[model samples]
Target chain A: MPGVLDLVGIFVFAVSGALAAVQKRLDVVGMVVLAEITALGGGILRDLVIGAVPPVAFTSVSYVVVPLLASALVFFWHPHFTRIMPAVMLFDAAGLGLFCVTGAIKALDYHLSPLHAVLLGVITAVGGGILRDMMSGQIPSVLYDRQLYALPALVGATVATALWQQPQLHGVFVSAGSALLAFGLRVAAMRWNWRTPRARGVGD
Target chain B: MPGVLDLVGIFVFAVSGALAAVQKRLDVVGMVVLAEITALGGGILRDLVIGAVPPVAFTSVSYVVVPLLASALVFFWHPHFTRIMPAVMLFDAAGLGLFCVTGAIKALDYHLSPLHAVLLGVITAVGGGILRDMMSGQIPSVLYDRQLYALPALVGATVATALWQQPQLHGVFVSAGSALLAFGLRVAAMRWNWRTPRARGVGD
Candidate 1:
């Protein structure tokens, strides 16, 4: 079930890229490249760290084709995606949460400490988004000095890791709770315009 | 002395990428991105693997500017770069060798095992070139059915790892010898068309 929901997260991220591409007035090739990077870059980074060759997305036929098709659809038909932006957000939150958990698991698999695992989880969740922004010549999300997107993933994954000793209790509930928590935090931040205090100084 | 060589390597790589950009007919923006990535990508990958943040390239102003200037030069003057192609290849080999040594030393600094450090060195040597190839939609050198490029880095760094265990030999000739071996191997391979035999049958 958790694995299935990860697909939804990938789709959500793809839609975000497609929208960004449209807004940028990009060609079809540009739209596909952005969508693939946004959806796949994080997992690729995570897997590479753990020494997973080809990464799962590269080997998995479903993961490879789905994003491309979605990009094409969005490229040709924007009206449909316009109505479903909210749904994409929900699923994307779920993806962020699930990917965060997966990152921690992979890091721990590499024998990293809890703190290190938590950091890796945060990176895995947000790395793709940052890459997408960089390729598009926009400021990365992390550079914006935004509130809690990465921090919440870090917290949620650490919490899950804390509870990981109960092997039987580890599957579905942890995934759901993490997804919900990340979603809630993101929604609250969006509504309230919450932000981390910027590094402030006058002109140097 | 080697610090200067490393920067020279960075310039060679940046120029190699910029020249590829010209050959590929990329725009100025594309050329800059390719050059910077070729110059910085391998080190960034090495740092991330060792759990270092921001990567050295981000923090180093000279590292950043040299690649940008290289790309700009290539964009404006196609004829000069073409004439200097042979010199660039020699420098590119030297740079590849230097990156391998630096990567191995860093991995050792992070307390990785000799085996892992050698692997890291190979990655550092070949990773940027392969990534540059991938972004340009070409087959990566690592995936090429060709002479030992990355493999020699693996071998040379392994020798460095063993030689460094001799307290008297640490940091003197061992490092330089390994780098020279890798560079010499590359030059030999290019000159003689030396190659690893294909593992699979060549395509019909």
Candidate 2:
């Protein structure tokens, strides 16, 4: 069975994908494709970078099915679904936290350096959304939006990596602590409408 | 030393990436990043899927430097470069042809099925451009434009994969033939302003 955290993360990511498809006014096939890609793209990217063959995403049937089902649900009930966009975004933040921490641990298992592991972790949290936004013909939200999105993931990943380096640290505790930090930061940023600084004079 | 064909392909792809960065009014750092990604993203994607770790692009200083040079050239000499945009695109077609054929051959070396090899080949040809377009906040030209961009690459990759299946055919000859077919088709498509059919209701 997939972990509860993993399923929750997938659900939120899938919903974000569905939202992009609806925003684009794409068809049913497009919705499913976008959802699957958005939900799984980050993990697939991490696996590839870490040299994991065929990736778990391709090897597991449920991984593929869950996202498609989420897309389908969104497609048929968009009116009710979009109404909860704010709550959904909050869940997405939580998913981001979970993914970043887990991704860092996985990279460490593969013997990546702490720096590379943290980078991979951040990628696992945010890469899918970048892919989705780009595919939808918009600037990547992480780059363009006035939110401290990517930074929170980076912070969480860094925390996870640092904790893992301690010989006495339990991996589960590291993961849980990292996730909580990231999740708290993301939720706070959203609630406060926090903005990351733009390059001076570039004026984004 | 990298093959002559590989260098030429990288040069053209780098130019295309730099063009995107310039259009987006991004800084020098952005130009280099975009160029590197455009020149190497497809091959990296292929390598990852094939379980090739520490992708060749990362290992080779030349591959990294060449694209940076191309981007710098474009940044300082935009007027001269843009004036020759048509010629640059022709070279890009040649590069596309080379990458698809070579990419398929590489996939075959890893014992992938012919179908997967061919798919990887096409991906290796066009994936970078998709990334570039997405980063530039535009719809991918391959998906948005009616031109036979991806089709030519698909034809070349399929040809390469099929020829590799023949015991009597030398891999070099197979690559040459595939590249020629794709390059010829792309040039013809450009000269004649040929187009692929769009989905009926998509209404391009």
Q: TM-score of the B chain in model 2?
A: 0.96
Tens digits of per-residue lDDT for model 1, B97-193: 8888888888888889888888888888888888677666567767865777776777677877777667778784778898988898888888997
Top lDDT prediction, candidate number: 2
lDDT for each residue of candidate 2 in A1-204, tens digit (9 for 90 to 100): 227788789888998999889989999888988898889989988888887768789897878989988998898888877899889988999899999988888888887777778767987998788778777877767654657787788899999999999868955777888998999999999888877643233445
Every model: iRMSD: 13.7, 5.5
- Candidate 2 lDDT over residue span B148-186, tens digit each: 889999999998888889878955777888998999999
- Model 2 clash pairs are none
Give the clashing residue pairs of candidate 1, or none.
Answer: none
lDDT of 1 by residue, A1-204 (tens): 656777777887887887788878899888888898888888887767556667889898878777897798898887778888777766777678778877776766666655556656776788788778777866455533345566667667777666665677667687567656766777677668776432121011
Which one wins on TM-score? 2
- The CAPRI class of candidate 2 is incorrect
User: Residue A192 of model 1: what lDDT?
Assistant: 80
Among all candidates shown, the one with the greatest DockQ: 2
Clashes of 1: 0
